[model samples]
Target: MTQPSFGVIGLAVMGENLALNVESRGFPVAVYNRTAEKTKTFMAERAQGKNVTDTYTVEEFVKALAPPRKILVMVKAGKPVDAVISQLKPLLQEGDMIIDGGNSLYEDTQRRTEELEAVGLGFMGMGVSGGEEGALLGPSLMPGGTPEAYDKVESIVTKIAAQVDDGPCVTYIGPGGAGHYVKMVHNGIEYGDMQLIAEAYDLLKNALGLNHEQLSEVFAQWNQTEELNSFLIEISAEIFKKIDPETDRPLVDVILDSAGQKGTGRWTVVSSLELGIPIPTIYAAVNARVISSFKEERVAAKEQLAGPSGKYEGDVQSFIDKVRDALYCSKMCSYAQGMALMGKASEEFGFNLNLSEIARIWKGGCIIRAGFLDKIKAAFKENPKLPNLLLAPEFKQTILDRQEAWREVLAVSNQLGIPVPAFSASLDYFDSYRRDRLPQNLTQAQRDFFGAHTYERVDKPRGEFFHTEWMENS
Candidate 1:
């Protein structure tokens, strides 16, 4: 079997591992990075015998690959990408495929695609997840661009993409920026899912006053359930239960309570706000991270603060059950926000995307992979345009059966003042969005004040418009 020609343009851990993965998949990888030292180092470490050549120059790098090549750009998302693209602009010939395999902004991807198209070059904005290892083996690949370019590269991508026992790891998400946009939402949902786990951990720690092993035991039990089974859940129990031999206590305690968030978490919150999708859980999760960063603030407030915070004692199982519900509901809200974003992007970008396929592909490998994915896969299969996760028969039934338990948890958490921000935010978004009238809709008024953005009237165009006294007087 002849190995197809491909080059990796970055040699970071992610890039290096990915190159090796491509090699493992039987495609000889030609890797080049901005730093010659790193490339030389990587070549020295691995490139031996008759298998490959490590080129020192862009021209040499381009020549090392077969014609009509597949060159994947895996550099840092922004300026580094532009610089590399500019360098390759002259080196790449007509009909070569350039894939951006970083966490790039989708809009920028669109702009670059248009620019590259003018030069007879093809572009694919890809979203690669599963981190370094995922890249080394097979990460879920979301490729968006001209179908011709995708088809040109699909042979290798399909052969190497990550999978469950069944579903494929790759999808030609749509044309233009659709792939990256889908990926952006994938990160957003990831934020929601992780935060939900954090909230559950908090509830268990607080309500039961559980120690590390106890909390670990709690998560382990949660994983036994079908709804919560996932990579995040499984590994998190490990994180909780890990003990320090010297300290004889859980490592999580010594670890700071602060959660470090990469930009994707914040991007999910901001983009959802722009699109008018209520992703309160994702937002609150981001906000929680921001608050976590306030180590000094807590200290400062302590010296100037008034009274001590209250404590609580309740049925711990009842508390756990409710926290579970809130997490599930928040999970639902985040998924809804993600699907909504996809729907909007699909319409706005003129792309035909299979949301069910997206769900099916997400089932096993990625951070958000869970049993819930199957329900989403089934729901969308039943109705591709299913309004939300909650509307799906299985999910709707799950929520309905559990709502009584969930409400009690929310009620107690509210009483306890344990800062159930993400959980409550999701519940609030759910109840209010379902409601016909939401008070304090200053967003409409503010929009009008700035751009003279006319509000739609409820009587006409849903009669959603608010009449200003100044406009009436004028």
Candidate 2:
């Protein structure tokens, strides 16, 4: 039997599909699961007649691999990951590598990498995006580890990763959990994108009084535009057109309103707060999901709350265009926030992340894939030290041109009693970012007055602090 070049632990959907992907790319793979029956079933069902070897025991799985083994772990994040690593640590030899392809907290990845390296073993925290189908086909891959570790698995991963005209959607994403950190921010941006789309749909349906068909048409048209072309918008158009066979109604209408999250979005917000970076758009999106989970409270509040009682009474087409512009503007702000957070994280954590490379790879396979990512890539390329996406000339001009329409959409939504928290938050973020002078002076004075915290003087040199006695030292 030919020695398998790669080994995979866990027989879940992601693991199974990724193993198959490697096998299909002409590399022999060894697969294993804790349960022997699952491995037996996988070989009988999915791996039959393929270049895949199935092993039941941890020893067999380890022995089946060739020297300098490359293993990919696709189990659940956190404790399950630690357990698997613990089992494999004693069995694995020097120079062998373990890659974690789960959505783990970056700090955990950092710890794992440090622990494994001390014993002459290679560890990488590689983030695989694009879900199950992407695993079988190709997905965007973010690998962070030593260059030596990346070189060992580079041939296999690059061959299996989603390819675009720019290059394969996989790269060495710096070291020490940089890959996972980027993936976390990616999920956070995805949350913001989804919330923004939902708000656009809500405004169109409730405010403009569009039915399912018209709503579908609106999203379909928006998808054709370069500015709004995205996987989320593309699928949203399809979602609106889906019919529930049992009820014979729009599938979306039949579905529950409460949304669920799997912690990455919340983690992004927490990281932003700790870094003192303002990601209001992403924060609002996470908050919106939390609020959505309180379906009963929202339902009860609907009856108790009193506000404006009529639909939008304006030009429908004009308002539709404004909503589109507003959505695009807000979407840019969300991306800006995420990118800025990564920039700050890179500085604080010593993760020399290539922002351009990250944006370029994200152009395909990932949920956030879009034409807009190309613009981002170019923006970073043009100015590698670009502080914010909003400051890029192209983005700046587009937002300036569209600010009026953005304002008008919010005004209309407010008038029609529609809650566009993500939209509103994004606009405020944009407004705040672009402003040279804000009302933080009063905030500083209030803080000083209450807590004796010193305030910086604008008239003096930067970083000069002053403490004023309010009420004449009384």
Q: Each model's TM-score, in the order given? A: 0.91, 0.98
- Quote the positional error of residue 110 for candidate 2 in Å: 0.3
Any runs in candidate 2 off by more than 4 Å, and if so which? none
Please report, in order, the local distance difference test score of every candidate based on alpha carbons: 0.79, 0.93
Clashing residue pairs found in predicted model 2? none
RMSD of 1: 3.2
Best by lDDT: 2
Candidate 1 C-alpha lDDT tens digits along 238-303: 998788787887788788767796687777667777776677777888888889889888889869
State the displacement of the C-alpha of residue 399, model 1, in Å, after optimal TM-score superposition: 1.6
The CA lDDT at 206 in model 2 is: 92
Q: Report the C-alpha lDDT of model 2 over 158-247, residue by residue, as the tens digit.
A: 999999999999999988899899999999999999999999999999998899999999999999999999888999999999999999
**Least accurate stretch of 10 residues (summed lDDT) in model 2?**
305-314
Model 2 scores a C-alpha lDDT of: 0.93
